[model samples]
Each structure stands twice: as structure tokens, then as C-alpha cells.
Target: MKTDSLSAKAKTRIKRPPSEVFAAFADADLMSKFWFTRRDKGLKEGETVKWYVGSDDGAFAFDVLVKELRKPERIVIEWMGQDGNPARVVWTFEESEQGDTILTVEESGYAGSNDAIVERALDSTGGFNQVVVAAKALVEHGVEVNVVADHVP
Candidate 1:
């Protein structure tokens, strides 16, 4: 029940190999199926990709900077608004004890005081929770999850 004033982490269990799940993220086409629909340049070290999400009515613009990229294991990216501030999402992929893959999405670096950061953290938590779930569905069951459902603003 924590809010956005502080950072938060979301986790999901996906019944897929780490490499496969990782592919769903590294590949732009694969990523579009579960996450943002729009396709842009793929992520690479020292590369920043811009995505034009959804229609003009609900379009959101953001930049993703690939900080660390390791195939089928981990990906660390910094996401931010046009002003280059707001949130940073770090996605970690690991194999679980049951052989399933676990994806952990952590967001930190919010602009504001401790109270304000924790309050706004809710917004980030909700987005990443949905994203991780969507990743699980798309990779494991071939189902697509709509993150915009009941989305406020």
C-alpha cells in the first residue's frame, strides 16, 4: 500500500526460460506484443530508444537508456520523462527454484521529498506491476495484458 514518494519493486512469476523471457524484452517486436505496442530502435549499450505509444489520444513519450544488457539474464534501463526526471525502471530476470523465470522490476529515483516520493511511488508501482504481469502472460501463455485498464490519467 505504499505510495510514490519512495521507490518500489514489483515481481512476477513467469513460466518460461530466462532466455525466452529476456528475448521478449530485448527484441522490439516481441516487446510490443506485451508492453508498449509501438516499435522503435532496439536497445543497446549507450543507446537511447524513444517509443511512441498508443494512439495520439493516449500517447506518451519517454526515453529508455540501456545501462546494462546481458542476454537472457538481466537488463537495466533508465526511463524518464521528457524533462529527464520522474522514474527509473530496472528489470532483472532470474530462474526460480521450480525452473520458472522470475522477473523483478524496480523503480527508483523520484524527484521530491521522502513523503512526495512515497506518494508518487504508487503510480510507478502500479505501472510496473502491470508490466511484469503482462510479461508473464505474453511469454508464458501467449496472452497479452492491457496495462491501461483502469489506468488513471
Candidate 2:
């Protein structure tokens, strides 16, 4: 059966430099503070990383293969979706005129039924929004708001 693919994109402006905002996602230590509960290590091209969320009891664990990594600019990774199909996630970081960073997240290659693809895309949009907001709070204000975790359970 031929399956349809879907994609989602989200953008946010953070009150920090592009390097700082990029570090928030590239560095496992900083990412764990706001997004995932734990990550094996920092993102590197041609490497795979495991990220755990929620309780970290192995219930919500996923593996991400880093396809490309450009410091303070862009990162691309492939991960499996709920349907067990691999999907690509790309993150772009651009420095704004006001010294802030404009972060854009795009996920594509979702293969499934129409309803499933739409649902997954919507969920990704909301999830990425929460993640960027949380990262903003943590990086700009030094506060761990836990917005992403709050939506989990």
C-alpha cells in the first residue's frame, strides 16, 4: 500500500544569540533541562543519540540519527514515528536584527494514513512550540518552566 507523507513546521523568536539558542538544542545537558528528560550525549553528525522523556523508565525512549549538523545554524536528524516509519527533522537557527534568534523546526516524511498523518503533524507542531518556548525561558531567563513535560502526563 502506498502511504502518504506529511510535514510540520514551527518557528519562534528567542531573546538570545543564535549560538546560545543552538546550544540549547545541540547540548544534551541543556536540552535535558527543558525538553527531554535525558539524552545520551550532544548531537553529532553521523551519530545516533537516545532521548528519554517523562519518567525516564524506558517507556518514552526514542533514537535519533544525526544526519547533518552545522553549528549555530542548522541540524538534521532522522527518527521513527509512532507508526515506526523514519522521519526527518530539521532545525534552522538565524540571528535576528535585534540580536535574538529566530528558530525554525521542520519535520517531514511521516508515512501513514491520512488521519494518522494529520494527527501526527499537528502533535509535532504543538510539541515543537512547547519545546521552543521552554528553551526560550531557560536560555533567556535561566528558568526551567517544564512546559513540555507538563503536557506529557
In order, candidate lDDTs are 0.75, 0.85
Tens-digit lDDT string for candidate 1 (1-153): 343436778998888889888888888887877677546656787788865576365677567888889887888888774334656677788899988888898888777555667656776788788888888888888887756543467
Which candidate achieves the best TM-score against the true structure?
2
Worst 10 residues of 2 by lDDT: 1-10
Q: How close to the true structure is residue 90 of candidate 2, measured as C-alpha lDDT?
A: 95
What is the model-wide C-alpha lDDT for candidate 2? 0.85
For model 2, how does the per-residue alpha-carbon lDDT over 42-114 read when each residue is reduced to its tens digit? 8889999888766457557888899999999999999998788788999999999998999999999987777
Estimate the TM-score of every prediction: 0.83, 0.90
Candidate 1, 128: how far from true, in Å? 0.8
Count clashing residue pairs in model 1.
16
Stretches off by above 4 angstroms in model 1 are: 1-5, 55-58, 81-86
